[model samples]
Structure formats: structure tokens, C-alpha cells
Target chain A: MTVSTLPAYPARSARLKRISAEYPHALGLLLLAPMLSWIAVFFIFPTAWMIWQSFSERGLQPYATILTSAIYLKVLLTTLKICVITTVGCLILGYPVAYVLTTARPSTRAVLLILVVLPYWLDFIVRSYSWMILLGRHGLINQLVTGLGISSTSLPLLYNLFSVSIGMIQILLPLTILTLFSTMVRIDRRLVDAATIHGASPWRAFRTVFLPLSLPGVYAACLLLFVSALGFYVTPALLGGPEQTMISQTIMVIASDLLDWPLASAAGVLLLVVTTSLLVLYSRFFRLDRMLGGMAR
Target chain B: MRAPRASLAVNGLAGAVLVFLLFPVLVVVLISFSSVDFLSFPPPSLSLRWYRTIFSNFEWINAFLLTLQVGALTALLSTLLGVPAAFALSRHVKRGQNVVNALVLAALVTPPIIKAISIYLYYVPFGLLNTVPGLAFAHTVSGIPFVVINVVAGLRGYDRDLERAASIHGASPLRAVLGITLPLIAPSIIVGAVFAFMQSAQELLIAMFVLGTLEKPLAVKLWEGVRVAIDPSLAAATTSVTVLAILGLVTVMLAGRRARPTRVAVQG
Candidate 1:
């Protein structure tokens, strides 16, 4: 959708373009320098520095402590748990939306997709903040609770595992739905119809045929969402209780609140390693370019 | 091509989920216009006090202006870098492009919290943390990828023959690109820049880590409000940003007609 509709650059003039004829790579290299150097300086160099600082300060001790200590391990495990839960929650909420999308009128699907995009484009911080407003002590949820006489006082909705999950789920549900919808739309409905013709119930046809066909999309969506959920800071920071401390927040504490750079860097590096491993796994099994390209559409 | 409508029960459940996803946005807008100080569902009465309050207050005004400047600067810088790289990947280079793509998309893969801390480490000793340029620079690392992905997506389908024709007609390669190719991809460029701008506008985690007293993006200010107290003024700021987002999204969807509206679609 982005590139194919436009015309291509099919030919170069026979006359040597003096500037590029001298060195083809020169122009290309020059074009790439700014972005490459920007990444090198701001991203690569700093990440290198952090890893270096993490090791140099205590000579592998920060990594060791994180590995050995139950405290750090608990946070790491909890972070993993949160990411998993968020992914599962997204899948649960998303399947119906995706199914609805495929079944809807085209105009209706367009509107549904746009509404999903609205929140998806919204800032993560703003979304989290809105959740705070909607779920806080004096928030809408609490007001409704009291107004409905369900509870005399505000339910503890704002700061807990529940709020954190709510915020993360809200942020991720659209993503899962879109991915599933895109994949679901491409499924050959005739296969399901064939199953129904072969004495399968509608539910049986869907479960056996459509569900199996859509597993790839589900896998891709879960992988993407889980990786993102692992690093979620805004939702957890704003909506979570003390028990909900994810690895990202723990790193922030080490870096900022506790002012322990080495531990922070070590933690940061651990996160990078895990995420990069997932990405590498993605590239290994699936063509990442296509995954990303399809994702773009 | 269509089957009978799915069960009514399925539609009912789906509608409920859609409402859940959209509720926060709707709630925020509603609260932003509330007359009462207390945060309540549906509001006690309608008023523009929160909206007016944001304009009159110095901090809110300052944060809003700062956010706008940072977002614009990030957009400009990212476009300057990302468009060419997109062209290079699309037209010129091929062998090491995967490595390039990986590096470009690294920011998306890595969590924002980690990016913030790492950038904070980079900026701290140089005294660049919290400064406008530094913040904008931090944003560009993430923003440039969007520019690359977007512009490259636009580039994939671009007709090279147009440039070829221009070059054959006595225009230099540079002029061919400048006049013909660039204009053709102008919508993609604009869409990329809009994405970049929106990235900086809504970014707060990095802002929180690095921003000094001098510049507070609206997101950061709102975060402070969330941390310190629940205030209607925060809702006002949120509503304004939401309006900007709507405009930006409309531009993006129009520009790259079929591209995913948000990077989070992939990121999530």
C-alpha cells in the first residue's frame, strides 16, 4: 500500500552521472550516514556504555546479584508474568473483535478499525493517564460503584495488579485485534463451509478450520504484544501497586531512585538480551521483513 | 462474498469490548469539559473551566508549547535523516539492508523504559539530559525508524521509470530525485513526519527520566499530575493532545492510504 502503487526508478542514464558515477556507494553511504551515526551515537554507544558500566562497577557482580538474589529474580519473574498475562488478555478480548471485523459490513469494519486506531495512535502515557482518571479513587468507576450502591466507598481500582492489567490490556487489545483481523480476513471461508457440509456444526467448523488457520496470526500477535508488555513502564508505574513492580520499574529504581547505575545497566542489558533473542527467533522462523511489512498494511 | 450475519450474541460481546477499548478516550473528553472539580462519571454539569484553566496557567501553557516545539523539531530532523535512508534502501543498496532494518527498528523492539534509561546514561555526563535538543535527540532515535518504515513502504511501489525518464531528459540524478521522485513521495514524507512529531508529543517515560525544570512536555506534566494529584487540568491537556492526534492521524491515513495508522499496531 505504501510503495507499490507509485512508479519505480527503473533506469539510470547512460551518461555517467558525474557525482554518483565516480562512486555509487558514496551517494548511498552519504545518504545513510546521518541515520546510522545518529543510532551509533545515541543508541549503540549509550547501550554499550551502560553494559560497560554495569560490568566495570562491580566486575560482573550486578549480573551475579540479579541472578542469585531472590528479590531481583522475583521482579523479573513477575515482569514476565505480567507480559504473559497481558498477551493472554489481548488474545481473549481480541478474538471476538477480529471475528466481528471479518463478519461485519465493509463500511462497519472500516469504522471499527478506525476507532481501534484512535486509541492505538494515542500516547501510551495519555492512555495510562486516562485510565487513572477513569479508575482512580474519585474516578468514574468508583463514582459508578457508589452511585449504583454496589459499594458505599470507592473500590480499590486504581493501584493494583487489576488496574495495571486493565491499562496494559486496553493498550494492547487493539493491536491483537488488528493482527487477527488482517489474518482472519485472508482465510478461505470455504474451508469452514466444507466442514459444515461434512456434518460439522458451525462451531465445530470454526474451531477445526478457521481457528487452526488463524494460529499464525495469533502467534505473531502474542509475540509482538508480549515483547512490548515486558517493557511497559507507564501503565505499571501509574496504575500498579508495589506488588506490581515490573523489571522496567525496577531498573528505573536502580538508576534513578536508588542511583545504582551498574545494577540498572545490568537489568537493562538483561531486558535487551531477552527481547533481542525474541526478535532473532522471529527473524529465524519468520521473514521479519514480511512480518513487519504485512504489519504496516 | 458474505455469509449470514454472525450470531447476535457475538456482535453484542464484540460491541461491549469495543466500548471498553474506547471508554478511556471518551471519558477523558467528557471529564475535560466538566464544571465540577471532582472527577465524576458523566459529570455533574458541563463547563469549559478545565479548558480555560489550561490556557491561563503558566505551567500548562509552557508544557504545551514545549511539547509542540520538541515534536516539530523531532519531525524535521527525522525526516531529513529517514527519507534518504528510505531511498537508499529502496533504490541503491541491497546487501546489508537487513542489518540496517534491524538497527532502525531496534527502538521498537527494545522497551521504552530501557531506551529511556540508556539514553539518560548517554545524556547525563554530557549534560544534555532534560535540555530541549537532547530530549528531541532522544526522541529522534525512536522517531527515525517510523520515518524509515513509512517512507520505505512508500518507496517499494514507487515507479523508478519516472526518475529514469527525468534523468534521460537531461536532468541530473539529483534533480530527478529532487523534482520527480521526492514530490511523488511527498505524502509519505509528510506522513512519516507526522508520526515522528506524534512520537515526541506523547513520550513521557523518557521525559520523566531526562527532562529538567526548563522543559516539560505535556505528557510529563500530565504524569506529574497523575503522581501528585488528580486534576481536571490534566484532562484539559489530554483533550488538546487528543485533538492534535486526530488531525495527525487523518493526515497519515490520507498520506499513506493503506499503511497501519500507528506503530503500536506492530509494536504491541
Candidate 2:
């Protein structure tokens, strides 16, 4: 478009030069057109329409229906509950990993850190399927239990909150560890040493010195994890039980199975509001670079 | 020096957590070699029978090929579209820059399910569903943020003097950027490209919505396989994708390592 808009060469070369000199930033603007256009047409337009459709469908009634409906509120509550539980689970599981990463010998820390990052690099679905194999009745855990003669029946490990949580905790565990580890690594080790020298116990040194220092990482991790966990569709949809379906699963059913775009859009708008608010907080205070570079050092 | 006793205990617990994280993948790999028809741990006997099944199956192969095609194109397109936008954000108009930044990275915050549903509703009339180009376009939205982040980092660390020198002497702004700036940030761009590939290749929900009636990609295929039953062949598929993901990540790491030297040179 820029090329075509250029003035015809013979008499207009001066004019073309004048325009280019005057508007140096125009090239940059021209460069952005393809991506901006695509995003506008595909992403922004759809999102705007979705929000509008939620209100326009039956004339501002979808919002009322969703807000008033017990089923919708229950699903929203389940989603929030799951997000809280998953955040807590990640903290408990990830804190030690981050602690070790900051405290271990360099060689040992690198290996330990890589182990966490390695799982994150894998496809979540593939990693999740690993749980699928282990949790099913015909799976190994069951085979072991039955073969050991401890129980006559296979454990109901699949399609439950426990299984879903296990899978998500594993997937989300890396993010928490990486965030907390970055913060923990920055903590001045001498402060903990200073506390130890004053006759405080090791636990006291950690609680009074280290834990408080690393709280930012914990905050960052919790905010990032909770927001991310809220949007989890694949793992919960695949691994969760009928009773354990989260808001995302409900949205999927409404969108595809029920063909209720208004209801689906309403659910989605709710999810978007909650997640975007948390994420805006994250993006405001944190650098994406640090999030990725936890192990780079 | 050896760590304190309590620290050693913490390290041991960390090891166990790592095991918990990696245990499922190891189980999947082991079960893939199961000689029996069903998934049982410590297989009755080891065999390559499942891998053989994937190799023999056309559906599996087609899905793999389509995944590769879509993933590669998504990577390429995201890079082309994203790198320029990154450049713009790095040194362009300051007004409305935050607005543009939010718009570009919007895909990251929005739930994939929401994107999938909204895009599906939007795409039905356009009949863009079930096409590789359609899926790639949807995926590119998610991938652009990686380029913006990585390349913007590169730009932040770069010396603007070189581009400025080129433009002041004789070169146009476009030439200065294309010739002087791009090569300096090429490594970051590559990392962004790899990220784009991984984002698309691992993507499932969006693929599910956009690829109706069309041949499913490996992600959809893998999802269907596991949902129906976790078989040895599904294990093989997961293993293949995992291997590819690891390979991609390792490339980014190596590139990042190489990136340090260039940055040091610029700083010096």
C-alpha cells in the first residue's frame, strides 16, 4: 500500500522524497498494518461482538439471567475455589523447590532448576495424559494395588477433583517455583547469615529473614497462578468429574453443545473480567523478562 | 560448604517434588512400550509395538503433518507480524503506546476458552473454521506477545547509535532498520519464533474450536485418544510431541546463551 501510494517517478520523485522526509515514522506505521489489521479483524472485533451479544441477545437479559441463576453462580464459585486451592497447592509444593534452587550448590541448583523448567517446556496435554494413564482403573497404580492384594477394587483416581488438582499443580508448579526462585535468589544471603549468627534457630532465620524477603515472589506467584488457573480449560475439561466441572467447562458446553452464544459470552465475559484484572496487576508490577529468566542465571 | 541439616531436608523434599512433576511423563513413556493392549505400569514386557502402530496409521501421520504445517506457519507468520510490531513499540510514536501494548499482548491475558468461543462465533459466518490458515491466524494472536517481549528486550539492550548513524548519513529509516537493527536482534527474534511454534503446537482448545470437519491436528488427535482411553499409541504421540517441545526449548536456551555475548559487545 505504501509503495502504491508513492508518487509517480518522473515528476513526482521530489514530492515522494518530501513526504518521506517529513513523515519518517510513517514507515513504522505502515509496517504495523498487517498485524494490527489481523488483530483488529480477528481478535478485537470478535471480543467486542461477544460482549455486545451478551447484552443484545434478548435485550439486556443474558446478564440478568446469568447473575440470577444459581447454576452460573455455583460454577463461578467452583472456578474461584479451584483457583484458590490450586494456588495454595502450588505454594506448598513449589516453595521448597524455589528454596533449594536459591540455596543449593551452583551445580546442584542448575540441575534442580532445569528439572522444573523441563516439565514446563513439555506440552501440558502430554504431561496431563501421563496422569491419565496412571489414574485410570486399568492403569499402573490400580494394577499395583490390585496385584498387591490390598484391595479388590481399583481406586477411583480418574475424573475427580483430586486428579485434576494433581495435574494442574504439576503444570502450574513451575511458574510458582520460577517466580519465587527469582525473588529468593535476589535475597541477600548475608541477612540470613546475620540472623543465624545472633543465635536464632535456622527456622527462625528463614521465617524472620528469608520468608519475608521472598514474599514479593510469593505474591507474584499467587497472582499469576490464580489468574492462570482460572482459565484452565483443557486439564479440567479432560480430567475433571461431572460434579467438578469449572466455569470454563460450563462455557464450553454452552458455546458448543447448547449453542447458546449469549450465555457462553456472559460466562466468558465474567472470566475475562476476573483474569484481566489480576493479569493487569501482574503486568504492572512485574517484568515478563524476569518471569522467563528465572533459570537463565 | 555443605548445606545446613535443615537445608538438606529441604533439598530432599525438592527432589521429591521434582519426581512428582516428572512422574507422569515417565509413566507415559514407560506405558508406551507396554507389550499388552492396555495401559499397565512396568509393562508385562517391553516392545516397540505402539510406536509401530503410530507409524502405520495414516490418521496419526496426517494429524502429525498438519500439526507440523500449522505450527511452522504459525511460527513464521507470528515472527513476520510480531517482529515489526516489536520494533514499532521499541522506537515509534510514544502517544497511545500503552494502548497499543495492551492490544498486542491482549491475547495473553484473555482465556483461551473465551478466545476459542468468541472466535468460533465470529468465524462461523466467514466459514474460516476447519482451515489451517484460520487456526494459524487465531494462534498468531497468542504468539505475538512472545515476539514483543523478546525483541523489545533486545531493543532495550541495543545501541541506537548504529541505526541513527545509518539514517543520518544516507540510508532511509526502513533501510537502516532492515540492515542495521534487525541483524542485531535476530537471536531474540528466533527465540520468539520458537515460542510461537510451541504455543501453536501445544495449543488444544483453539484447535478444537477452529478445526471442525477438517483433519484434526496432533493436539486434537492426542486429546481424543486420551479421552477415549489412554492407549500405548497415545503414549507414543505424547512422547513425540514432548520430544519436539524439549528440542525447541533447548534451542531457545542455547540462543539465549549466545545472545549474551552480542549484548556485551554492544555495551562495551
Candidate 3:
């Protein structure tokens, strides 16, 4: 009787284990349900609704108006211009920093990295406000110039294209540096040493071997910087005059000040389209996971 | 060795860029202590008047508290939603993984202004506008990507054998996960929480639309102040937020250092 009961219990437990093992996929589905549902309701639904709202009232008329209207077209162009400038500025400023970070000793790299990343973690409002303090009429730059007798009066440094560009570039430089550094660090320094041994000058070796290898990183960084700069609102709004109105600020004004929901939605859709297309292109070249992973580190 | 001249140039350029990066931050912190009414490079006398102003003013205090509350809520909600999703994505749900990933990360790719406007419109019809929960929910959509990215990374380095061992030792699946996996990944979750909190706290565009008139977070309050006029009080508010952020960063770094050894030991 004892032997028969033991065999029966073993058989029951084996069946239960099999059932549980088979249901892992179902368990996964259950686990994913909450986040997926939350995203669908809060993220996807609103986005689709906004797109629908854009075309609901006037069909494609709003798009046509945006295309034809001088103000809207100019704002879009200005946004593109600022984004290009900011991207270029970040590249020029960030490359040396990234290169230094990749080649520096571990201890020095840690401190340099912290200095670069500290501003990134700060709020845009803080950074932009800081820029205002430095660029305003009584700002440090103006004060320095006036005190040195270089100029009799303060320069109109705040609320201009120059200020806008400076603020945006400063804000975005860390992102560019980090992205470039991630790619640069992966490159074998031995390759450059090889070129040098083979009678190539250091500058020539960098230009021929290292530069080509690092171009992909440059492309990726520029894409990210341009995409980010395109969506900028706070820096431009604070540091720019009416001339530097970005597509984002325009959307805000249309939505809030003008009370033009369809036009605003249409403008938003256009901005979304441009940014999404660029990112999609970016993902085709580089894995999104790697980019995000690089940023997190 | 490479030429000394090139190395010196690189170091000099890097140093200049670092100074450029940090100068504005330094200026802001310094100006916050000014005794003068107007913006100035050098404070004639150092004073706590602006800090006192921020503390004494009801609106500023209200905004600060609201921002903290929203940030905390966003961190909690995103982590609760994101951790399980990370586990599922990394370990389970094999089919359509790419599609799911893209869907999860779509928020990060989408322009912030688009997100702000869309959420603002959606919330208006649902009567969710100007409510803390509403704004928190909006922020959570953005926050989830940060949480998922961090937690998924943590899970990738994790060994599945630990869970298998737990099960073999008669621990149920849920019990094993709760007892072992969660604790092991707690540092990642905490870091994710920090990112989520910072994202929510620093967010201005969405908060501008979602919490328009009745409620204001610190970002919005600063935006208003900066738009109207530049004041030392604005500098004081920014300084406070920057200091808080620095503390958060320091805490995360320490936590990461402490967790590193334990993680390495477990793997070995």
C-alpha cells in the first residue's frame, strides 16, 4: 500500500510541473498586458486622436495652409536652420571632448564624464535661465565688454539668433560627446599604431583610418542632435527673438494663443513625421538598443 | 608615444569645452546669492534674500511641492509598469518582439511637443486636464521608456540559472522571481526610478499644456517667471532644483558602486 501511494503522488506532481512549464508564454502575455494596455490608452490613442483631429475639421486644408502661409513656412525653415547650426556646433565642440574621454586614463575619464553629464541631468529651465543670466543686458559677457571699454554700451546679446544657437548648442553638446565617445572607445587604438609603424604620420593615420571608422558615429550623433534640436522649445523661447521661433514654439502658440486646434495638430503631425522618419532611417543604420544603451551608460 | 603638441592641444580644447559647459551653471548658482534687485555678474554683497523669497512665497512653495509629488508618482508608476514588461520582453513573449520593442520605445522617438499637444487634447475631453493624476499619467508615458531601457539592460546581465535553481529547490515561479530576481535587479530599478523622477521633474512642455492655469509645477513656474522678467528668485529656484538633481545623481552612483560587487559575486 505504501509503494502504490508513493508512485501515485510522483505521477501527480509530474503532471502539475508539465502544466506550469507549458504556461510560461501565457504568463508572459499576462505580464505584458498592464504596460502594453497603459501605453495603448495613454500614448497610441492620443497620438492617433490628434492625427485624426488634424484632418477632421478641414481635411487637408490645414496642411495646405501651413505650406502656403509665410509665417508657418518661415518658422519651419528657421527651425531647420537652427537645428543644422546646433548640430554642427555640437559636432565641432564635442569631437575633441569625446576623443579625450576615449583615450584618457580611467580616473581622468570619470571626472571628465561627470562634468559633461552633469548639465545633461539638469532641467532645461535651469540651463536656459542660466544662459539668460549670462546673455542679458546686464549679463556677464556684456558687463565684461563694457568694463573693458571695448564697447561704450552693452550688446544686445539676449533674445537673438546667436543667443539661441549658443544655448541650444551648450545644451546638446554632452549628448553628442557621449554618443561619439561610445563609438570611439570601441575602435581599436592598435589600428592607428599599425598605421604609424607602416610610415603614416599621426595626422595622416587618423584621417585615413580612424576618421573613416568614426564617421558612422558622427552620422549617428548628427542625426540625434538634429532631431533633438528640431523639437526644442524652451531654449529658443527664452533666448530667441521672434525670428528664432521654432516649429515647437509655433505649435504651442497655435494651440494655446491662437486657439487653432486643427492647425496646431497639423503642425504637430508634420513635426512628428519629420522626426519619426529620421529616427526610422537612423534605426536602419544603427540598432536603437545600442544607441539607448550607450546613453544610459 | 604620440607627439606632445597634439595631446596638449586636445587637452586644451577639451578643457575649454568643459569650462563652457560648466560656466552657465556656475554663473546661475553664484547669481542666486545676489543682494541686488537686478541681474549682475558680481554680487555686491552675498545674501539669502532670494532663497528666503522662494521659501516664503506660497506659489513658489506650492509649485515645488507639486513637482516633487508628481515626480515621485511618475517614478513609482513607471517602475511598477516597466519592470514586469522588461522581464516579459527579455525572457518571454518571443513572437513579435521587434514590434513590441518599437512600440515600447515609440515615446522616446516621438517629438516632445507632439506628445505634449496630443496628451493635452486627449486629457481635455476626459476632463483630466489641470489634475495632478492627469499630468502624472502624461509624464509616465515618457517615463516608461527610461525605466524599460534600464531594467531590460539589468535583466540581460542576469543569469536564468538562479531562477531554475530556485524552482528546483521547490520555490514557486512567482516566489522565486519576487525573492531572488527583484532583489538582484533592485539597483537597476532604483536607477530607472531616478531617471523617471528627473524626467518628470524637468519636463516643461507637457506640463505647460496639461496643467495649464489652475496647477503649476516648478518648471512651469520658472517658465512664467523667465518669460515675464529675469529675477534673482528665478536663479534661486533653479539652484535648488540643480542641487537636488546633483544629490540624486550622487546617490545613484553610490548605490551602483555598492551593488557592483554583489552582482559580480552572484555571477561568479
Candidate 4:
């Protein structure tokens, strides 16, 4: 609907000529110098160097071990497992919320929608700390359970897989809701009505009509959440024990604590490959642009 | 149009989800007032002892200041770079623009940890590690993509005929841009800046890589506090950060409300 409607103001010859005479293409280049230079020096160079480091032994046996090592392979599998679980969890939790946001009255839903996304404004560290407080042995869950006379144990809440997953789910739910809401909002309610009018059950109507149409958004959101979950650092580091260490944690250990840049870069490149491949698969199934724009709604 | 029951169900579920999402943050604020040193929720006795402890901590103070500095620098650098790149994307139909867009989008799509590790490797050479400037630059990379995406969306929706009309009336391209385009997209620019602020401020993984012990950002401090200290003082710091975030969100929401009837959907 939007793409075909791009307004093309017919260029008047005189203005075009005059603008060409004084366009200062050089000036545009000059204006762009600082930004371009910064990106080149800070972003591009670093990425290139990381790739280079991945292939060479700077401080370790760095011959780009594609099939020689099992550690990177293990980290890759671990990242994938975590990401997939987080994505599925987000979908199950977020879908209902997105449905609610789309179906509710605009005025009432506005506050809820704002609340849904408000956490994005909060610092990640603060959120992690809140989880730390809530899931710690002396935190809310333990306190509540003990107060209720359910058990005397502290519940083994913090520094575990459960804590890490919960913290991640908390961070990721808003994104899933937002994306799902976008696509759901655009779904024609009349289609669902039509399906029901044809004697389809409410579930059948939704399953056949609404779900298929919203798949683009759902798939996109999952892609986003999964890819993001792959790179999680603070949540896992703060909440998870050493038994549940993620690739990001492992990379940090190798790079900073262990001082092994080659290993770190290799790990990074592995993560990048896995995430990018997933993203490509997602884009193949859905239009990323539509998902992005739709979700912003 | 009148699916009242379904709408109600949605509303009810949404309310529950919102509570679930927000409950932890609220709990932290509640726990900060506990009289005991250990974090205890639904406090047996309330006091401002943790607040006092947080205020007295020099590490917290230094980390907070450094975070502010980094956030400010991130916002500034992102705006400077992003606005023009956005302008180019919106105004011109250049070759390989899609590819350029994809690359910029990649920054957002790639896992933050991967970007951090990649940038860390990049930082090792030329001694860019453990510096305020290097950390700021890294944050800027993450933050700029948001700015560009938002500003581009804003500009894409704008009426280019207005620019044509202005230029035809003897206004130079530079004048047309400054006098018209920039002012028109001011709301998006503000949104972008706010996003940049929040993103850089909240960032933990990359900041962990680039900054040194003396230059640790607040997120790093919070991480250390939670992992090692795990006390009410950390809760106090959490409360402080939450309040600041709420303030920023409120300001942005109000500004967005005043600027226009509906926000120009600025996606990243």
C-alpha cells in the first residue's frame, strides 16, 4: 500500500539546473567526513581485525579451526539451544498479550501498551538487579514461600538456569508483544468475522485466518528475540551459575579474564554466523521491513 | 467492531502481562527500603538505610558519573552521524542503498555480545581498550543504528514537494534542509536521541569490554553489586536507575505527544 504510493515531485528543469550548479556534492562528502571516518576507523576496522584474528594465531593456535576443535561447536550448540528456548517462551507468553493489545479499545489499551514497552526505557542493569533481588535466596519468591509456610528452604532461586531464563524472558517479552501487536493490529477483523460467519469455530477462525496472517510478524519477532538472546551477557552472567555459562560469558572469559583474543574472535565469529544464518532463514519466510514497521505500531 | 467479550479477555490478559513484566522492577524499589542489610522483599521494617549506603559508596558515584558521560557522548555522536546518513537514505535513491541499509540493520540484529567481542578484538590493537572514548565509540555504534532508523522513517514520510517548493522559491538546498527538513523531523530526532540515551545508558556487555576498572559504567557497577554484593544497597542503586529511566521515558512521551497528534513510527 505504501511502497507504490511514493510521491515523486516532477523536477522542474530550471530548479534542477540551478540546484545542480550549486549542489556541492563535494560539500555533502565533506559534511559526511567525520561520520564516515569514525565508522571506518572504529566499526569497520575492528570488525575486519576480528575476522583477521579469527584466522591467525596472534596469541593462540589460531588457524581458524572450523573442524579441528569441539569447544566452538559446543558453544554454538549451547547458544542455539538457549536462543530457541527463549524464542519459544517469548512467543507463547507474548502472543496472548499482543492479542489483547490489538483487540482492546484504543484509549484503555494506550496505557497498557505504554506499560508494555516502558521497560525498554529502564536500564538493563537495573532490570538484572531486580531479577537478582527477586530470585535471590533471601529475595521475594523465597520470602513469600517461607511466609506461606510452604517450605523452609530458600528455594534455590538465584544463580541457576531458571533464573537466567526468567530474566531473559522478562527482557524479551516486550519485544515479542510489540512485534506481534504490530502485525495483529493490521489484520482485518472482518476476515475473522467472515470465517465465523461461515460456521468456523472461534478457535478455527483464529487458527486458519488470524494466525496465518500474523505469522510474518510472529516469525520476525522470534528471529529478533532468538538472535538477541544469543548475545545475552548481563542477564546470564548475573543470574546463571558457572554450570550454565553461555557463549558470551565464555568469550568474555577467554578475552578479558583469559586474555585470548583469537579464541574470543573465533567464538564471536561463530555466534555471528549462527545468528546471521537464522536471520536469513527468517527473512526468506517473511518480510523483515513489514515486521519492523508493523511492530513499531 | 463490537467484539466486547474478546476485547475484555485481551484487556485482562494484557493487564496480567504488564504486571508480570513490571513486578520485578517495582519489587526492587520496594526492597530498597528494607532495614536489614540483606535484600528482603515486603520489608519487615522500612528505612532509608540502603539509600544512605548507596549515596556513601564512592564506586557507585564514579560509575554513575561515567555512565552519564558515556550516555551523553553516545547521544551526541549518534545524532551527528546518524542524521545525515538518514537524510541520504530518505532523500536519495542511490545504488546499493539496500545493502547499506542491511549493514546498518546488522548492528541491531547481531547479538550484543558478539558485537562486544568483535569490537573488543578490534580494540586490542592501537591500545583502544580500557578507555572512556573507546567505550563511548562502541556505544555510539550500537546507538547510531536506532537514530538512523528512526530519522529515516520520519523523513521517508515527509512531503518532499515542500522541499522542492522551497528550493524553487530561491532557497538553497542547504537552506531548504536546515529551514525545513530538520525542523520537520525534530520529533523523530528527539525520539532517536532518547533511544540513544537509554540504549547507551543501559548497555552492559560492550561497556564491560571497553572500559577499565576506574572507568566502569553504572551497569557494570550494578552487575558487580548484584553478583558480588547482593545487598539492599544494590536495590537502592536499582531504584535510582529505574527512576531516571522513567523520567526519560515520560519526557519523551510528553514531547512526542506535544509534537504531533500521532507519533511517526520510528522502528529500529
Clashes of each: 14, 0, 0, 0
Model 3's i-RMS, to one decimal, reads 5.5
Give the interface-residue alpha carbon RMSD of model 1: 4.6
The TM-score-based order of candidates, best leading, equals 3, 1, 4, 2
In TM-score terms, which candidate is top? 3
DockQ of candidate 4 (2 decimals) = 0.40
**Chain A TM-scores, candidates in order:** 0.83, 0.82, 0.88, 0.82
Interface RMSD per candidate: 4.6, 6.1, 5.5, 5.0
Candidate 4 chain B, poorest ten consecutive residues by summed lDDT: B259-268
Q: Tens digit of lDDT per residue, candidate 3, span A1-297? A: 011122223345456446647775776787788989999998999999999999999999999999999989999999999999999999999999999988899988888887887786667777888888788888789889999999999999989999999999999888889788878888999999999999998789989998999998999898889888988999998899999999998898899899999999999999988987777767667644445443445
Ranking by DockQ: 3, 2, 4, 1
The lDDT leader among the candidates is 3
Q: Candidate 1 residues B22-115, lDDT tens each? A: 9888877788898998767678888999889988989888888899888888998999989888888777776677677767767655788778
lDDT winner between 2 and 3, please give it: 3
> TM-score for model 4?
0.85
- Candidate 4 regions exceeding 4 Å error are A1-38, A58-72, A146-154, A280-297, B1-9, B156-176, B248-268
The better candidate by lDDT, 1 or 2, is 2
Which window of 10 residues has the lowest lDDT sum in candidate 1 chain B? Answer: B259-268
Give lDDT: candidate 4, residue B216. 75
- Give lDDT: candidate 2, residue A175: 79
| Predictions in order: lDDT | 0.78, 0.79, 0.83, 0.73
Candidate 1 local lDDT, residue B180: 73
